[model samples]
Target: MIVDSLDIQKEIPLWALGDGEKVIQREFVFENFKQAFEFMTLSAEYAEEIDHHPDWSNSWNKVSVSLSTHSVGALTKLDIQLAKAMDAFASQVNSKN
Candidate 1:
């Protein structure tokens, strides 16, 4: 089910909330490329496990992520969950550096 935009706003206020098709987006920066890759690797495993992938890209020490349920072309719990998981992974990766 598509999650309400208002709920998403309340849940992750730091993320950029776009209207309609733009969806939710956030950028994570690491101390180095190695740390960035670590975060992505962790997120990839989790995404695969849940069968929900993210639209994301990495360059050097930064990663940009956008979350939405592509099947329905809308925001959903899966996107929210993946966003939070990626956030946690970023935290863990940053802490390790």
Candidate 2:
């Protein structure tokens, strides 16, 4: 089911685009390319484990991430869960810097 934007906003303040269009977006910047790659690696594994994937891209030390439930055409619990997990992974990466 699609989540309410209000709830999403409270949970995901780092979202670059307001969580009103069935998508959650954020850009995570790391200290370096290696750190960025490490984040992606961890994210990829978690995504696979959960059977949900993100639309993302990486450039140098940055990773742009977008999450949406494509089959439902909206943000669902999975999207929120994945976003939180990704945020945690990003936080861990940054803390190591």
Against the true structure, whose lDDT is highest? 2
lDDT of 2 by residue, 1-97 (tens): 7788888889888885445577889999999999999999999999999999999999999999999998988889899899999999999999996
Model 2 TM-score, all chains together: 0.94
Tell me the tens digit of each residue's lDDT in model 1 across 56-86.
Answer: 8999999999887878878888888988888
Pairs clashing within candidate 1: none
Model 2 misplaced stretches (Cα beyond 4 Å): 18-20
Candidate 1 residues lying further than 4 Å off, grouped into runs, are 19-22
- What TM-score goes with each of the models? 0.92, 0.94
How much does each candidate deviate from the true structure in C-alpha RMSD?
1.3, 1.4
Q: CA shift at 38, candidate 2, in angstroms? A: 0.3
- Cα distance off (Å), candidate 2, residue 87: 0.6
Displacement of residue 82 (Cα, Å) in model 2 is: 0.4
